[model samples]
Target: MEILDWIQDWFKDNCDGNWEHGEVIQITTLDNPGWEVEIDISNTSIATMNLAWIRNDNGKEDWYGVKIENQKFTAAGDAGKLKFLLGLFKEMIDKIEA
Candidate 1:
């Protein structure tokens, strides 16, 4: 599924009023391009995750950064990295619901 679709579906399936009241997910568009995504799962079983895409970085394209657990872990990569991150989120949701 498309990332946006997955995001919507995930929220629909997981949020139970309180999560939405807490503002669990946020997305903002950068001035240049790309997006800044913040997911607050700290209240949940999983940790918080932040994702941002750099328009241009030292002549590199598709540069993205991810910080988890308030920078307890960090990574930089491309779009594929976001896909992997989403997969991890799905797994966490499944585990928590199960």
Candidate 2:
């Protein structure tokens, strides 16, 4: 199946309880045939952190991202880790292109 389809299914299965609706903003395909799927949740306030497993030509790689902080989620640990994941994503994409 296509990456987009897989992502949609995965999100639907895992995030159905959290999100009411959302949209895919962009899908950047790397040279390795892997993709970066950028989705924007409509209910940003209600939306929680995304702990999805990213797969490339290599294998399954996990990533965590979100911009929300509440007592229920992410009270401890590093919230800035999301930025680091983005940076790593950029580097991986660039490397694939190069």
Candidate 3:
């Protein structure tokens, strides 16, 4: 499945009556012309997992970083990396579910 669709399904699957109130996922744009994604994993399946920072940088247009901190999955990257960032999240989720 596409990254966005997988993300949506993950979000929908994790939503409890009150979990959505705190906002499980947040996506925003950076002033450096990049994408930032933060997903709250508290009370979710992957909340207990430990993930180190994952980063790659080849140039201004080719950089991405991801980490799990404070019970949340956070990632940032160049504009073109939005889908890639979400794909990372899906991969992690897949592993946790598997």
Global lDDT of each candidate:
0.56, 0.37, 0.89
User: How well does candidate 2 match the true structure, expressed as C-alpha RMSD?
Assistant: 14.0
* C-alpha lDDT of residue 36 in model 2: 45
Which model, 1 or 2, shows the larger TM-score?
1
lDDT (Cα, tens digit) per residue for candidate 3, span 54-74: 889999999999999889999
Two-way lDDT contest, 1 vs 3, winner = 3
Off by over 4 Å in 2: 1-24, 42-46, 52-98
Give the TM-score of each candidate.
0.53, 0.26, 0.93
Q: After superposition, how far is residue 94 of candidate 3 from its true place, in Å?
A: 0.2
Sliding window of 10 residues with minimal summed lDDT for model 1: 71-80
lDDT at 84 for candidate 1? Answer: 52
Candidate 1 achieves a global lDDT of 0.56
**Residue-level lDDT for 87 in candidate 3:** 91
